[model samples]
Each structure stands twice: as structure tokens, then as C-alpha cells.
Target: MPILWLTVIVLALAALGYVIGRRRALASGDGRIRNLHSLPSYYGSYVAMMTGVPAISLMLLWLLAQPFWVNSAVLADLPVSAVADGSSSSLVMSDVRRLADGLDRAVAQGVMTEADIDAMGSDLSGIRTRLGNVGVALGSDVSTDILTSAQDYRTKAATGRLVMSILVLAVAIVGFGWAYQRTHKDFRARNVVERGIRYVLIAAACIAILTTIGIVLSLVFNAIAFFRVYPASDFFFSLTWSPSFGGGSELGILPLLWGTFYISIIALLVAVPIGLFSAIYLAEYAGPKVRGVAKPLLEVLAGIPTIVYGLFALLTVGPFLLGIFGPDGVGWMQAGTAVITAGLVMGIMLIPFVSSLSDDIINAVPQALRDGSYGLGATKSETIRQVILPAALPGIVGAILLAASRAIGETMIVVLGAGAAARLDLNPFEAMTTVTAKIVSQLTGDADFSSPEALVAFALGMTLFIVTLGLNVFALYIVRKYREQYE
Candidate 1:
């Protein structure tokens, strides 16, 4: 909560700084003649970036480290007997927290004698107060060892944040000042800023690339460990997915993949036509008011929680299908808990996902193409069908691919909607399971990490990552080439 407030405060300050800086720049500028500095917006943007980014970065770092630091401090205070064995960080932290709170409660309840109660209360209170005091302190407290540790954590945190903030501000100021100083007849500060922006974009791309590499490497290493025990052949081609409980287990991808493909294909079949037509109608037929009202209404589909979709699948669709297909009745559909039910519900969920993107891509098709088609006596549908769609094809394909990726990775809908039995089956109405569902099943209450059953999840994860990455790459490639053609 504090971190969110800090971020909001920083952003607000940045916006205010931007507004003030822009106003100052404009007021000082000679409107009739050129001035010696940047445009008003640049100065404002400079201040805004400086004000927001560094503080946000500090907040992010603080968020990541807070639990670790708090746990370490609490652990240091614990009596050695509390965590004598070499326990994991999670276990140790849990015990220390339990002990501290228990001591406080015992004291409150008069379970402990007065002397013990006083000392325990003092220790807990001292630790809490020192942690608070250390947050904004500099250098070290120097009063005592525990106090010094607290202060050191605080000082380092504060100093790091100060440094980052200064760096970002210095950059913004330098950019603004340089742009302002060079604002003469021949000066092209616009070009300079654009070039700087290009670099900024490249940096953003690098960050994404680095993150992808990190994720891939993490999955690969763990997958290698999984393969050490389980044969790759069995995992890939074995038609059954009966995960071993204790002694011996079989880890197979075929069943999970079967379920994943079944659900996704069903989702796509439902999503594509409805989504495409909606996009067409939005882009070509709607008035401004209709478009505005309808677009948001479509997006409301996206905002509906996945859990809701899951419940609709389970409670409504599943039982309905079960009633028709459960042997006593005419079976058009086999069962509600089958791939079709989850897929149909999920497809409804993804309509807006596809529609919104398809709308953007369809709109991007050149008006010239439509004009040419009309000149050739093409009707409205003909122009859209023949020229506009083909022109927008690559981008449309990209949009569908993006939606496909979302469907493939979807967790909650499958967990609630799809049955948990992992097995290969061609029947969509039959109970089926997906990779994500399997992951959840494997990691539940009695998970044994050393066992093959638990470790196979890494292999499943690796396969999922590779598949999604390939889809995204293909989409990006198609979009890039199409974008070039339009350019």
C-alpha cells in the first residue's frame, strides 16, 4: 500500500513538474521569433520523466527486497532453538513470525509471568520501532549492533534511491537545457529528441529481450533436471499422463498437449468468425457514437474475470451437456465438462480480445485501396472482402495469433472449466486436461519436489514457453513485414 501511494505521489509530482516547466518555457519564449531553448512540451516531458521514473524504480526495488530484509531481521532476533535445523527461508521466516506474535499474545493473555512478559514485549517493540526508524536513516545508527544493522539496511536503501533519482533528474535537466540552449534558426532540437527517443525505444526492446532470455534459461535448466530422471521419448510420445505419486511415475506430454490443443482449437473456431465480423462492422459500418458505445461494450467482455468464465463453464454448460449426453438421452454433445464446453465459454471470453485487435488492423488498411475497389464498381462487402482484408491480412493474422497465445496460456478458465484428468482423447466432449491444469495438479497440497511427478512440471513449462514464444515470434514477423508493405 505504501509503495503504491509512493508511486502515485511520484507520478502526480512528475505531471505537475511537467505542466510548470512547459508553462515557464512558453512564457519566456518570443512567439514572433525563435528562442534559445527547447519547445515547451520537451521541457515539460523532461521534468515528468525525471520526477516519475527514478522514484518508481526505487519503489520497485524496495518492493522486491522488503520481505527478504524483514525476514532476515526477524530471524536474527529469534532464539537459536526456534530454527535450529537448516530450514528453508520460507519455513524459518514463518516460524519466527509465529513465535513473535505468539509471545505477544501470551503476554496479553497473562499466560507468562510479569518479568518475561515485559522483556518479550520490549524486544518485539524495539525491533519494530528500529525497523521503522532505519527506513529513512543515513550512515548507521551506531548505537548498538542490531540498531546498526537496521540503519545500514535503511541507509543503503535510501542512498541507492537518491542516486537513481539524481541520475534520472540530471539526464532530464541536461536534455532540456541542451535543447533549450541550441534553439536558434538552424537548430533542430526536434531531430535530437527524436534520435534520443529512438535510443529509448531500443533500450526498451533490450529489456524485453533480456527478460525473455532469463525466462528461457530458467525453464531450460529445470527441464534438464527433469530429463535426467524421465526419458524424453516417454514424455513426448507416451499417450497417457498418469503422474507417479511416490515410487515410480510416468510423465507424458501427449495427454496435456491433446487437451490444450482441443480446447484452443474449439476456442479459435468460435472466436474467429464473431470477432472478425465485429471488427469489420466496427471499422466500416458504425457511426462515431455507435462505435464509441459498442467498442467499450465489447471490451467489457475482456474485463469479465476468468473465474467467472470458469464457473459459467462448470455450473451452466457442464451440467447442460451432461444431461443430454449422460447415456439416457439423445447425445448431441458428450458432456459439459468436455473440451467443447470450456472452449466455447473461453471463446466467448476472447471475442473482445480478437475484435479489438482486428479492428485496429482493419482500420490500418489504406483508404486508397478501398477507393480503387469502389472505382472498379466493387460493392461495400466486395471492397472489404477483396482489397481491405487482404491488405490487412498480415496484421489480422498477427491479431489472431496474439489471441491464440492468450488462449493457450489461459489458466483459470481451464482449471475450473476443463476436467483434471490428463489423457489423450480425440473426443472434445470427453473429459480432458491441459498443461496448466496439470501444473496446478502437480503442485498441490502433497507435492514432492524430488519426485519425477513434481519435476515433470518444469518440462511441461519449457514446452509451453517454447510454443508461446514461437507463436509470438511468428506474429511479430508477419506484422513487421506487413507494416513495411504499408509504409
Candidate 2:
């Protein structure tokens, strides 16, 4: 409830601040306001941050401290033995608090029965008696009153925060209104607001960076823990992935890598040509009408969920392929649910990803370059082939690597499409498992996290993260180099 109110208060304050700032700036009628540094929302956001952030922060701090403070005060009133030797300050504190809450609930519900009071007494006694046995299992041992009082205090604090937030917004509005009324030729309201807003934007950017860092840190810790158990050599080098459950788990990651690479290879082979052609058609051949209609339609491929692709691989493509080579006509293929089926489906899925990006890069190529080549009597195809593709090549490479990242991170499609076998087989027709496949399977139903089998997921996740990061970095390098060429 406090969190909800805080959000509401923040937004209201922000909106009020924005409106006030905007009106003040508009009324100023100065060339400075017209040429003002930043967006109107910045001032509003600034005021909102000012009103809400500190208040909410203080509220949170108060909420955290209030319980301990209240609990300590109540415990001080109780007998020394009631403190239960401080063996379970943490546990007995909760017990005392619950007992206090129990008393309050009895009053709230109009239950004046001896049983209610007895219940509260039992809560107190339970803590003192169970002091020696204090551990994780113990919950609380207080009266209904103290807990209810705590809840009521928390509510009051939240309400106080809301009132303060609203007051701040009102102050902003009144201040701006009063200032606007006194708007002489020398008024600098816009400057004041814009300055405030720029800082707010900086804060937002910092927040995004911090969040990214936090996520990376979490993944790093887990990866470190995983490497502690499983040797790095086995994860990267060993080419025979055979993770175990009950028996001795070989935990080879090679087969998974092999499957992932195999599927990705087939997808890239299918996508590159098709995607490149589609991009060329859109950028060079298609009319504005055709381009307009086809571009979004092509992007629909990207919009389709990977799970849909997996289902297609499973129910549709898997069986069709199996029928074609099920030890009958030519026996070249093993089963319908093989690497090719998944790869082919995944390729189709990646088409829009490649085409759309390539289209943008290709379209970005200087029209003057094409015109220069054409003025020399080169054909349209020759001009485009000679000029556009070469210019867009780096961007195209980056796009492909971006698609590759999507392919590697893809779990649902492979989990459904690729066979659940950990064999290092050469045949694409044979069932092959990937890193993601092993991760998914290893963590299912009765997972033992401490065990090597369960810990394997972390190692595999780290591998996936590292691989994707490398791919992105390489793509960034290519894109940067390409951008420099044009610039």
C-alpha cells in the first residue's frame, strides 16, 4: 500500500511540477524560454523527483527502523527472562511481535473471549519456552496490538508521505503561479526549470547503467560459483556432453555446444542468402508501395514468438522430416526431429531479423553514390551491386551477428525442436542436444542445486552469456568500423 501510494504521489507531483513549469516558461514570453535548453517534461520530472524521492526514501528507512525500535521498547517492559537469553533476538523478536499482533486482532474483531487473551499469553510463553530451540523455523511471539500498532504506524507514515508529496506538488504549483503572476521582463522561470530537469535525465541514465551492472554482477557471481564446482576445461574443451542425474555425471558440455553451433550454422546458411536478397529487393528493386507493404510483413517473422517456431518444429516440421528419411526411401535422415528441422524453422524465424536490419543499412547507403555509378552508364543491378552492398556490408555483418545472438539465446525453439540427446554425432539427421537443452533438462523436477547436475545450469548459462557478449562486441566493432567509413 505504501509503495502504491508512493508511486501515485510521485506521478502526481511530477505532473503538477511539469504543468507549472511549462506554464511559467510559456508566460515568460522570452526568447530564452523559446530557445530553452531541454524538454518541458524535464522540469516536471525534476520537481517530481524532488518531492517523491527523498520522502519515499525516508519512509522506507522509517519503516525498516520502526519495527526494531517498537520491538525493543516493548521487550524492555517485559521480564528479563522474557527476552529469552538473547539466543534468538531475531526469532524471539518476531514471536513477541506476533503476540502483540494477536492481542490487537482480538480487539479489532470484537473477540473479548478469555481464549483470545489466552492465545496472546501462549504466544509469549511459546517464545520463552522455545528459546533454546530457536532457529529458522520460529516465526513470531507478540501480541495483536503491537503488530497492529506497527501496521497502523506504517500506514500513517505512508499517508504522511502522500500528504507531503501532495503538499510539495501544491507548493510547486502555487510557487509557479505566483511567480508567473509577477512575471516581469526579467523573469527566468524557464531557465530555472530546465536546469532542474537536465539533472533528472542524468539520474535516469545512471539508474539504467546501475541496473545493467547489477544484472552482470549477479550472473558473474553464479558463474564463479559454477566454475568452482565444474572445471572450466570440461565446460569449454570436452566435446562430449553427457550430464548425469543419479549415476556419475560426465557433464560434458561439448555435445550441447555442437548442437547449438550446428543449428546456428544451418540457420545462418538459410538466412544469409534469403535475407540478403529480401533486403536488396526492398532497397533497390521494390517500389515504394511494395516496400511499404513488404517491410512490415517481413518484420512479422521477428514478431512471431520462438515458442511458435518450436511448436512448428515439433508438431509440423519434425514429423514431416522424419517421414522423408525414416529408414524407408533413402535413409539419409535419421528422424523428423533432427538438427535440420530446428535449424530450418529457426532460419525462417530469423529471416525478418536479417532482412529488416539489412534493409535499413542498405537504404542508408548514399543515393548520390548510386547516381554517380548510373551516370557512367552502369545498369541498375550493376550500380547497386557495386555501390550499395559494399557500403552496407559491415552493417550487414553486424546484423547477422545480432541474429546469431538471438539464435544462441533462443531456448524455447531448441527445447522443442532439437532432440533431447547428448551425442557428438556428425549427422544433422541424428538427434543432437545443445547447451540450452542441457540447462533446461538439468533443472527440471526435483532439482538438486548443490549437486553437480543442478550446478551445470549455471555453467551453461555463463557460457551462453559469454558467447552472446562476444558476438555483440564483435558486431559493435564491425558496425563502428562501417559507420566510420560512411561518416
Candidate 3:
């Protein structure tokens, strides 16, 4: 049976259990209004939980475990000849699985009968042609050993599926009967259902936390693996950025870090003043009609994807900058793609991040501060500059840090606008690149993953994670320090 059909059957059983349990509880109340300890809905929910949760949990466990069992069985059954021409057992097993699936497809399409498949000799004659007729292509002719393994694989899989279907239905039915018998007027069905929900919520929270820890651990392990093979000193201190998959590559991060910081600095220089001023205007000076029209327009920039901004940098902004500073003009910039172009476009992309967040933060300032400044005969500008801004400083700083984090992590804009030239040049108009761009370049194509060239991507990722974590921590510290003053 298909997993989807099995899910439907389990849900149907749960629904039947719910109706029966609710009716049983109400009938036990003898039609009296206040005879039950908990509501009828609680009894229904308890039955549903009991009927669905165990069966679904069992199915999930079966699905997770079956693949390992099946793969182990097939691997053990295969002889030494199955792994031909330096191929690993894992790769050979993949071929076996594909061939098994193709045979099943052939059977489903009526191109072959089960009896015919069973009675076939070990020569495995015409198997490829028959499977091909059913739209399952093979890279080579079937080996006799592989054909035997695939047939065994299919048989074991069929038996497992049959067993799973029977077991899942049995558990669902048993859970239904158990919960139905326990449902009575005096049972604490509400408390039982509430406890189950609490455990579910706790599990969800733990899953999220565990996922973060898992990611951090994976990065740390891979980075350790990379450092074991490649010198950490060279990776951290060298100024060059070159990687050769063949061996002996100089995997320096200084050039990439330089480019990343230079572009992000340019982005911040463009975004901060403009975004802060816009926030000030929108929050303190704009009328209601103007605020309504302008706020959404400002936020629309955020919704426009970074990819679109990258394109704009590539096609529009890069060319425009080239016309101003390229060799054909003032001879300062060599091409359309340069650090300035990417930075300018990235700054534009981050403007909404700064402006939208700062606007809300400025608005969150207490009205009493503004009133006190006004009472002291201060002008509106003076009041805003002295009182309102001071109160919202922490939040504004937090917003700027967030925007900086966004700028540091941007890949597409840097790739498209900033030319892929990793250097520590002083000129903003010159082409440059970032760690993210280098990480992508190293891992892409037919690069060997075990090489330092590809593994360096993980180290770079860990660096990014650390940098952003520091920024967030600093932002939190600033917010916490001044939050009491504002409150």
C-alpha cells in the first residue's frame, strides 16, 4: 500500500474512534449536563490522539529503519563481483535500486508478468530492452549478479511494505479500542490531552535547539577536518586567494575578508545616513496620509528580492559606474563590475532593513520625552535630535548591526556586480570579491570534496557564523543596557 493511503486509513480510524469515544462518554453521563468531569470535546480529542499518534509514530519509525535494513540485506547478499571496476559497494547498491525500480515499472506497465520474471534464467536476457520500453533507461547492460540482487531487493521491499501495512493498521485499531474503553464521565480526558499538547510543544522547541546545535557541530567538525589537512595559519594569515583541486593550493582568507569588509563598509556608508534620515522624517515629521503612503513604499524595497538587486547591479549600476570611471572615461575603473557597483547596489538593498526597523524603533520612543523637550521651549528639530534619538539609540544601533550582517552575508550582489577578483586593493572602483563568493567558487563544479579546496567552504561558513554571532551579541548588549533608561 502507498504511504499516502495508509495515512488516510489511520486518520479515518482516528475520526471513527473520536466519534465513538465522545458518544460513549456522553452516554455514560446518562444525558445529564454536569455529570462529566471534562467536556465531551476533550474525550473526543483524547481518543483521536491515542488512535493517530501511536500509529503515525510507528509508521515513521518503520520508514526510517526500513531503508537501512533493506540496504544492509542487499549489500550482504551481493558478491565481490557486484562491485566492478573500482566502484564502491554503495554505488553498486544504487544501481541495484535503480534496476529494481525499473523492473517494477516494467511490471506495472504490463510489459512483463511476475511469473515470467520469476522463471527467467540467470542470463538476464532482454531485461534492459524491456525496462527501456517502459521509460526506464540504463547506463549499461544488466550483469547477472546485479539482476539477481535487484530481484532479491524487490522481494524484500515488497515483504517489508506488506508487514508495515498490517502492523500500522493493527496499532491504530488497538489504540482506538484502548482509549474508547477508558473514556468515561470521571476520566481526566482534558488533562491527558493538555499534557500531550505540552509535550508536543516542548519537543518542537527541543528540535529547533538541537537543529542549531547540529549545524554548529557539523561546521566545527568539517572545519577541524579542513585545518587538519591545510594549515590554519595560511588560511587565516596569507593575503592570497587561490585554490587548486590537484593539491598545494594557497587558501588565504585575508583577500576575501578584505573585499567583504570593504564592500560592507561602502554599503553601510550609503545605507546608514539615508535610512536614518528617512526614518526620522517618516516617524517625527510625516503626516498620517503621507505616513500611510510612504511606509509601505519603503517596505516594498525589502520585498524585492536580492537577486533582482544583483541583476540591477550587473546590467544597470555596473554600466553606469563604468561610464563614469572606466578606462574609456577617466581610466580609474577597468570594467563594469567593481567593488563600488556591488556596494552601491547592496546599500540600496539594505536601505529598507535600516529604514523600516529604525522607523519603528524611533516611533517606539516615549511621547513624554518629546513633550518635555517642547515644554522646555525647544524646537521640534532640537527635541527630536536631543530627546527622541537618544531614547531610541540602542534600537537604531541594533538595526544598523542587522543591516551590516545582511551586507556581510550577501552573495548574489557581490557575485554579479563585484568582479570575481580577490584582492586587498585600496581602490573602491577596482574589482573585488568576498568570502561568500569564494566559498561558492571553491565548492562549485567538479571539485573534489575531500580536498582542502572544497572543505575550505565549511571553514568560511563557520567564520561567517562567528562574525554574525558576535554582531548579534553586541546588538543585544547595547539594547539591554539602554532598554531600562528608555522604559
Best candidate, TM-score-wise? 3
Clashes of each: 3, 24, 0
Candidate 1: stretches off by over 4 Å: 1-213, 332-335
**2 against 3, candidate with superior lDDT:** 3
Angstrom error at residue 322, model 1: 3.2
User: What are the per-residue Cα lDDT tens digits for candidate 1 across 1-487?
Assistant: 2345545656777787677756655656654225735565676665565556555655666556655766565556645553445444455444344444443444456555446534544354554443343342222211233333333334444455555455544544554444444434334435555665687689789889999899889878888988998899999988877876866676779889888988998999999999999999999999999999999999999999899899999999888877877665666555567787889898999899889999998898888899999999999999989899989999999988988988998888898777787876777777888998887777775554656787888889989988988999999999999889987
Best by lDDT: 3
For residues 102-183, could you state the per-residue lDDT of candidate 2 as single tens digits? 5444444554343544454445444334332322132443443333343444344445556555654465455444544543
lDDT of 1 at 236: 94
Scanning candidate 2 in windows of ten residues, the lowest lDDT window is 129-138
TM-score of each: 0.68, 0.71, 0.87
- The reply for model 2, stretches above 4 Å from the true place, is 13-49, 56-189
lDDT score for candidate 1 against the true structure: 0.72
Worst 10 residues of 1 by lDDT: 136-145
Across 21-62, the per-residue lDDT of candidate 3 in tens digits comes to 899999999966489999998999899999998899899889
